[model samples]
Target chain A: DTAVSQTPKYLVTQMGNDKSIKCEQNLGHDTMYWYKQDSKKFLKIMFSYNNKELIINETVPNRFSPKSPDKAHLNLHINSLELGDSAVYFCASSPVTGGANTEAFFGQGTRLTVV
Target chain B: LAKTTQPISMDSYEGQEVNITCSHNNIATNDYITWYQQFPSQGPRFIIQGYKTKVTNEVASLFIPADRKSSTLSLPRVSLSDTAVYYCLVARSNDYKLSFGAGTTVTVRA
Candidate 1:
């Protein structure tokens, strides 16, 4: 079974369009995260949620919002997408423990292209 | 900003040992050194984690110094499929936000 999975593996939209990516984890993890990889292949953390609680929000644009309906799912909605919004988005999850569950497992990633 | 610096790229041949080094001069006491690997169209995958000395697993081995100033990820008998980007991260506590750098791109030659 895949530990983490994201829907819509590929997305292509025009500028000013709206899109959403869905992520789910079956590892029963309490924490989930969203990361973006740019054209240069540089990865950056965008948001994180723990048990449905928003924990970390990087200085992302207002057009991007992360919604976590429960402990197992975190979805990202992008509004007014721009040309620079084109990149690969990743979903990750990790179990919360004293310290044993420190590693984060990532999904296959979604490639978004904005024209 | 992250407290680590690693090479921009590395090259290795098939069936050779590949070691990528990352320097974290200001690693905290409670920080853990972790490594992640990324392919062309995939998210980063956790490779291994270590606090000090040496740590070995099925995929890779992590070598951390006593001072925790630096760490090395050693891949045993790499293949062409191992060509990808590797990231070294300093995970601080459970809730500390993760910071990712440019990462070292490993190119495995045939």
Candidate 2:
């Protein structure tokens, strides 16, 4: 069974449009995160959610929003997608712990292309 | 969280032992050193993790000295399939907020 899985493995849309990517984890992890890898191949954290609460919110644009209805799911929605928003978005999950040592399991990633 | 630094790239011949070193000068006392391997078009996969001294598993070996300021990931008899980007991450805490560094890209020649 896949530990972490994501939907819309490939996405192509026009600028100013809206899109969403879904992620799910069967590992029973309470923490989930979203990361974006740019054309330069630099990966940066966008958001993190634990137990349905927001934890880490980087300096991302306000147009990007992450929603987690439950511990096993975390989804990302982008509004008014811009051309610069084109990149590969990855979803990952890790077990919840008091401190930080848990290793995260990542999904296959969603390639978003904004025209 | 401790930031790690590694070489941008390395080249190795097939069947040779490859060792990639990562330096994390500000590693915290509770931080654990972890290594991950990522092939192009795929997410990273965990390789080995260690607290200190040496830790070996079926895939790779992690070597950390007493100071814990640096660590080395040794891959024995590397093959073409082993060519990928190797990332070194310092587990910030048990909560699992992992921060990834640029990582070292290893290219194995036939």
Candidate 3:
């Protein structure tokens, strides 16, 4: 079974369009995260949720928002997507050990292309 | 979060062992060093993690010196399938933010 899964393996949209990517984890982890990787293959953390509560919010643009309905799911929504938003988005989950984060399991990732 | 520095790239041959070193001079007392590997078109996968001394797992080994200023990840008998980008990160056990730097790309040739 896939521990962490994200929907829409590939997404192609035009500029100024808004879209959402869904993620789910069956690992029963308490923390979930969203990460972005650009053409240069630099991975950057965008947001993190611990047990459905926002914990980490990086300096991402306001156009991007992350919502966690529960500890098992975290979804990313991008508004007015721009060409620069073309990249791979990954979803990951990790368990909290004595208030600390442990190793994370990542999904296959969703490739988003904004034309 | 401690900043980690690793080689931008490395090359190896099949059956050869590869070692990539990472430097984190300002690592905190509560921080731990972790390494991840990423293949093409896939998310980064956790390989090994350690706080000090040496840690050996089936896929890789991590060595951290006493000063905790640097660490090394060793892959044994690498094959072409082992070629991937390896990332070294340092973060507190409680820290939820994981900052990834430009990883070392290991190219294994047959």
Candidate 3 Cα lDDT to native: 0.92
Scoring each candidate complex against the real one, what DockQ results? 0.54, 0.50, 0.58
DockQ score of candidate 1? Answer: 0.54
lDDT of each: 0.89, 0.89, 0.92
Residue A113, candidate 2: how far off, in angstroms? Answer: 0.8
Q: Which 10 successive residues of model 3 chain A have the least lDDT summed?
A: A95-104
Which is the leading candidate under TM-score?
A: 3
Candidate 1 lDDT over residue span B1-110, tens digit each: 33789999999999999999999998877778889898888888889988899999999999998888999999999999999999998876665366788899999999
Measured with C-alpha atoms, the lDDT of residue A16 in candidate 1 is 95
Q: Candidate 2's interface RMSD, please?
A: 2.7
Residue lDDT tens for model 3, A1-115: 9999999999999999999999999999988999999999999999989999998899999999999988899999999999999999999998862123468899999999999
Residue A12 in model 1: lDDT: 96
CAPRI-style docking class of model 2 based on DockQ = medium
Residues B1-110 of candidate 3 have per-residue lDDT tens digits of 78999999999999999999999999989888888999999999989989899999999999999999999999999999999999998878668877899999999998
Count backbone clashes in candidate 1: 0
Task: Tell me the tens digit of each residue's lDDT in model 1 across A1-115.
Answer: 9889999999999999999999999999999999998899888889988889988899999899999999999999999999999999999998862133478889999999999
Which candidate, 1 or 3, would have the higher DockQ against the true structure? Answer: 3
Off by over 4 Å in 2: A97-101, B94-96
